[model samples]
Target: MSNFVFVLDTNKQPLDPIHPGQARRLLSSKKAAVYRRYPFTIILKHLSLEPNSTPSQIKIDPGAKVTGLALLQGDKVIWGAELTHRGFAIRDALLTRGSFRRGRRSRKTRYRQARFLNRTRPQGWLPPSLLSRVENILTWVKRLIKFCPVSSIVSELVRFNTQLMQDPTRQKEGYQQGTLYQYEVREYVLEKWGRKCAYCGVKNVPLEVEHIHPRSRGGSNRPSNLTLACVPCNQAKGNQDIRDFLSSKPDLLKRILSQAKRPLADAAAVNSTRYALLNALKKLGLPVTTGTGGQTKYNRAVQGVSKTHWHDAALVGETPQLQFLTNNPLLITAKGHGVRQRVITDKYGLPKQHRGRFKLSHGFKTGDIVKASIPKGKYAGHYDGLRIAIRTKPSFALYPKNGGKQFDTHCKYLNTIHKADGFAFSFVGGDSSSA
Candidate 1:
């Protein structure tokens, strides 16, 4: 099933989201018109005397790479989206800019005095990369609120205890230190073992936390005793000692033993901005609730729900028996608004080409979603995707959403579908309900 479409009244007041079929019928009868294309919102032509909008709650599962969003009306998930943040992109951009500045200074050019320890950061300061993740999540929260009647926010305020994983007895508080004990151990093992099967050296497969020294054979629950192995490998080496398991391959056995003993310093690449995210959500003045990773995992496990980011989100906190109404979720990738640099620079910081002051050409801008129809040519066809502007030129690049070859097309043949908002959109389908 696809996500439900958001609806709005004549005054632009948020209303209950309707199924896509209902939305199509409303548009066919000329009762509603398209309001926004990105979130697929429809606006009624006439004002409603009584708005029958059901209050929805936004549940977020924030991660380092992607943040899952689910709009839950009661126990049913109506709309779902997975937002991919570009934090690493921002970090790389900053690094490149700094390198360019430093290179220019070292080229025997006239340089300004070095400034150090002069700028003081405000309280709760975060690196730009980390801050971008929070900002990306917050931006979607505001957008969803505007398009849907969000009554409350639920966020997974989870962190990892690297110290606990390394030394479980160091803190006697017993696993409830942000994440579940088993999950912490599994996470640490995955990092230390490079997320590959320790037995077969296989990668990208689901791994099980296998004891190197068999637990049945008196292996203690230490981080050094845990390793990861693929399902097939684990089953094949069931309860076998590490040395016995890899007796034929003595070299591989030695390597695994040595690596498992070496402690990993940063096993928990936890999202440091989880509390910052919580604080920001609290400032929204809505009833905000938080859940732990352990709680989320328990909720998901008891329901036997298949693990997807959006599925995890729906089971965030105080969840009832959930009903999955949609299997396909909107995929949103945060592509920041174009940079402000006018003079394009080369590796040596030399000016290569100057960019135009205006980004629009014939009422169309870069990143705007457009539908194009070309009568006849090598690239002749109908296309619907974001337009890549060819500065001051009449032709723009058309990137089809259906994995078609990209080609340049004339602006006259294009129709605007959705204005760009610093995000790329798509969709993916998978079963998120119980297996």
Candidate 2:
């Protein structure tokens, strides 16, 4: 199976997506023409389409990091993408800017009026780091709607509960007590060790309930002494005290003991912005349905499908089964518009150089998808969404879509395929032709 081919009528009105084979036939028979490259959309040349179309649903698996998206018609998944966010990049950029500003102000400059508490955030204001996530998702959804008749949306609002998973007995014993009785020993141990082997830090492996103190040496089975460790680590540390075993790695031992006393702190920060995402989705005016990580996991398990973002997305919503899904879905990285207009600065917060005001050069800009055919040159081949830097006159520095070595290419040899849509494209699981 492959991604659903986006369809459009002669008037450019949205229509239900068709199979790749059907799209191929239409292209071969000259009934349709390729409209977009990344999503593989086609527009009808002459055929009149009805206003009514099949109801298509967009499923989203929102996460603190990578987000999963899928477009489904009936039980068939037509399009899927794993949207990688640059929230951390945005945060780092802001931090660098702040550091530079602070450094500049501290160096023999007249004191300015304090701006603290003067600037007020408007209602529903979100930090740029968080807002970037919401905007990225919205951008894709809007683009999809322009090509396909999307009727509804389903999104995963929250991940599975850590406490419930760590201690299953809590379901019956209530919040205060569980099977172990003393402060939910298993849950504490799992959280304290971060559900991974304490020594190796290997996760997703079967972890054995371990004792920091050797039981044979009078180590109690209390929650304070319990920790999670992989089978290999447990065997290696058999009958040995934790401090003695980790004597060579003093820092690791200190970190483990220090973290054990504190609860997980990052979860709250990750989840705080999700409600704002949900609200943004609702503004699209579609009937939005929400699910939890537990439900998504259950659905995926029942379907016997391998774990992937697309599979998780297909399993979302009220759909009973997924009749078809692409063996290789497109992997899209949301590289925001290459429009940084700041002057380059040195390490000491001094301006090193000024950037050019003009964005266009030789009738093309960076992030533009282009095809180049140079008969005799080092940079000779087809390229898509290659980021370019116009340093010289005829030749420009070209960076490959996928991370690799960059080279210079002539402007005359390059043909613009698509204007940059504020995204960088790459294929995952298989070749681009499979999509």
Candidate 3:
């Protein structure tokens, strides 16, 4: 089913979200007008007699890369959205800018006086990349509150409990003793290797903890040095180095080594921001509820719902028998409203093109979603996409949503659908749960 439509009163107060069919009828009967295209909102022509709406709760499943949001009314999920953050993109941009500045410093500012290290960060400082994830989630939560009668918040606070695992900071003597240690290591390895034999990539078999570097050869009992292997594979590679065991399969050997060295960056990012997100939600004055990843998984499995970010969100905390009102979720990617740099430069810091002070041209700004109708040309047809760039001339560059080649379309043929909001929106998975 399609997502429910957000509705607003004539006074601009948020009303209860209604089904898409009801919204379509209201629009067709001239009782309501389109208020927002991205969220599919409508405004009533008359003020709502009952401005106070039935209290709905906002459920969130915050992740490292994407955060899922769902609007729950009673036991039914009315609207859903998956927000994709630009953490890596932000980091890359900052790195590029730093490189440019460093190059200039080395080339011409060698004699410049060094600056004092006087900068002090406040308590609870986060890197810009990680901070952006929290901000993106908060932005959407506030926006959803403005469009729905959100009275409470529910969030998945912990993806996995690090306390249950081995603490790298602890001394070897401080490690948990006996079965607890074995349990922690086994659980961690199962998750890391997908509960399969890491050597043969075989699943649904009895697997044993195998060492990458054999214990007899001075290998440490660190989690990174451990992997899963079936009985035969374990026996075959017993007391042998992983390199020697997988000598014939160089590619698999390399992959295993690389994966073993891979740090839990994604998990760390989520853990770092969980408390910040919780604090932000509490500041909203709503009764915030929290759940763990295990609880969410159980809730979803009990209901037989397909695994997806939004689905997990809808089943986050103390969930009842859920009735899904929508299978399609609005996909939102955080494409920050262009950059502040006026001049576009190349790798060597040479200016290539300068941006106009004013982005508007022919009554349209860059990033505005538009529908273009071409009467006749190489690209002669109706197209729907974003206006990536605007020209002083009549023609503008249009990037099609359906992966078509970006072509310039005249101002007369373009109709604005949605204004630039630093986000690109689309819908996916109407008949299924994978959105």
- Per-candidate Cα lDDT values, in order, are 0.81, 0.74, 0.83
**Per-residue alpha-carbon lDDT of model 2 for 1-435, expressed as tens digits?**
778788888888988888799999999999999888877789999866456589999998775567788988788787888877777788888998888778768785664534787788898888888888888888888888889888998987755343454556665336334332432355346645778898999999998888888889997665557788999999999998888999999999998777665654334434666678788889999988877665677677778987777788777756687875576677767677764757888888787998877667888876677777766766666665566666647787776644568788888878777777766666674332111
Off by over 4 Å in 3: 109-114, 162-241, 376-380, 385-388, 429-435
Per-residue CA lDDT of model 1 for 74-116, tens digit only, reads 9999889998888878888899988888887888677664579
Ranking by TM-score: 1, 3, 2
Which ranges in model 1 have alpha carbons more than 4 Å from their true place?
110-113, 159-179, 187-196, 203-206, 211-225, 231-270, 347-351, 429-435
lDDT of 2: 0.74
lDDT of 3 by residue, 63-147 (tens): 8888889999999999998999999889889999878877877888544544778999988888999899999999889988898
Question: Per-candidate TM vs. native?
Answer: 0.84, 0.82, 0.83
Clashing pairs in 2: 4-78
Q: Which ten contiguous residues of candidate 2 have the minimum total lDDT?
A: 175-184
